[model samples]
Target chain A: MSEKIDFSHVRFLVVDTNRLMCQLVKDILMMLGCTQVTTARDSEKAIANLRAGGYDVLITEWNLKPRSGLELLDWMRTDGGSPDRMMPVIMLTANSEVEYVMESRDKGVTEFLAKPFTADGMYRRLVSVIARPRDFVSVKGYFGPDRRRQQIPFEGPDRRQQKPE
Target chain B: MRNKPQFIPNRGELKRKAVNYKTGMEIKLDEATLKKMEQLVENSSAEFLSETVASLKGLREALGRAATEPSARKEVLDHIREEAFQIKGMGGVFGYPLLTEFSKSLHDFLKELEDLDELQQEIVSIHVDTLYVVVSHKIKGSGGPLEAQLRASLKAAVDKAKPGTKPAQ
Candidate 1:
């Protein structure tokens, strides 16, 4: 593929209850050539920053202390959110069973990373997600400075595809 | 009678290796942690296992794509190195000493891939193949045995890189 992902522009927000996972993911993103990486230990912090804007990607662990990771993913999938309903999410967890893939697909998860991941694996997943991120609407606003509702249509070639207000 | 499945000896041998790996690693843990993990292993629902397996599959696919990128070779090798480091550190935490050792050796072997000209592609292929085996073992619920195999492979790869050792294992 001749496409080059503009590294400086891609922003990431990582959410994981596990400190190890967060740090490891941050390091992996940095290694993958991602310059902007923000981390949150829980959904509340992640959502707060997410509301504030600027993250191009969201990666969260499947298991959490206060709430389940899937629950958080469900909340983010609703109509009114920064990512809208189509934001790209990569779920990282120790749960490596087969059935969960179906469940994650239903929740709009773009990718999954089992715990004990290698840097190469993580980098590739990040590349694939960034290359084709899910675009959703944030109830509060878009990824930019303005709070204006933006629809990122992922179905066709034109990424800037619009929807009727 | 509960429907019974016939077992081939080779498959049984592989399963036996897996179980032996689990038992051997169980001895390395402290009393408290081992007990806790045992409970977790027993109580773990099938749903959790399935999710873990899917993630591993995704990771395997990612590795496959990365191997073909000749220009991204350096970046990909660095990524592989990082993976080995994480596996080494976390494998022990998760009760897999064999994986930790495997990760250590794999990380070392991956480092060698950064410089060699003639053998670089070959080394990359070996690493990816080893990774596939690891994922397959995990799916079969024999991640520990896979770890054992990986450790041996990593060690052999590392040894080959050193002076005086045979380059092929």
Candidate 2:
């Protein structure tokens, strides 16, 4: 699977305040054949870059200076500040608590990678976002990728049931 | 309800156009480049670890000052927590899972130090000292019995200091 996916043309934007972490993420992306990887030290710069458009993916740390990655995500998904609201976003964080994961999921994160992650783990996430692209669903108070990954056949009557006339 | 036309004349054309547009934008990975990347990640660990050690040393010095300076305690503790947070994130990546665990404990402990009492200050000092030992010694893998012993002692001290409260695990 790693061999088949070509990241040479994919443009990535990495957002993190830590210089070393940014360098590490950049190196990993460049190693995966990504030629253009732009990085921002904080959410403001990242948002400005996103507004300019052309990035195919965004990798951001959960904690950023002044504003958090979640706040940035919320702005992108709902504020109409972004050129592409459905852009693939991968969140990086050290907090592996279930609450954090759930919060990111609910906020419309495409993928979540816990820190101290391996190269293979990062690659897998890249592949998951690119190869298995999920359809975005936008309804009242909800807008993002389909949360459900597995589909089961429904043989019975319409389970939703018709609304009262 | 009236029956509607099942077919839309431009639907197939739209689908075909979408496919043609996507075919030109497909991403391709170069095998050679990926192999180079794997090697780079392997080689970068040592450099990363050394940098981490330097950062930890700086944090230790700050922690020492924060312990004694009451006026600057709040600001210094915040800085220490931020540094510890970074260590927590990168420690496991550089082959020091125990460092990550201990740093996380330290970060959590620092967060709960709003009203730094003398005993709380001592506990913070212990965490900083222990972290310095762990990072400087390059303690990889589990610390085994020694790790357990350290944790037990720290926990006992913290419990004694606070009373009716468990220390960060």
Per-model C-alpha lDDT, please? 0.54, 0.73
Q: What is the lDDT of residue B94 in candidate 2?
A: 71
Q: TM-scores across all candidates? A: 0.43, 0.82
lDDT of 2: 0.73
- In model 2, what are the clashing residue pairs, if there are any? A6-B28, A6-B29, A7-B29
Instruction: Give the DockQ of candidate 2.
Output: 0.32
lDDT of 2 at A154: 85
DockQ of the two-chain complex in candidate 1: 0.02
lDDT at residue B54 of model 1 (Cα atoms) = 53
TM-score, chain B, each candidate: 0.48, 0.66
DockQ per model, Cα: 0.02, 0.32
Per residue, candidate 2 scores C-alpha lDDT tens digits across A93-163 of: 88767898999898889899998787667777786776667766555566667677788888988523433
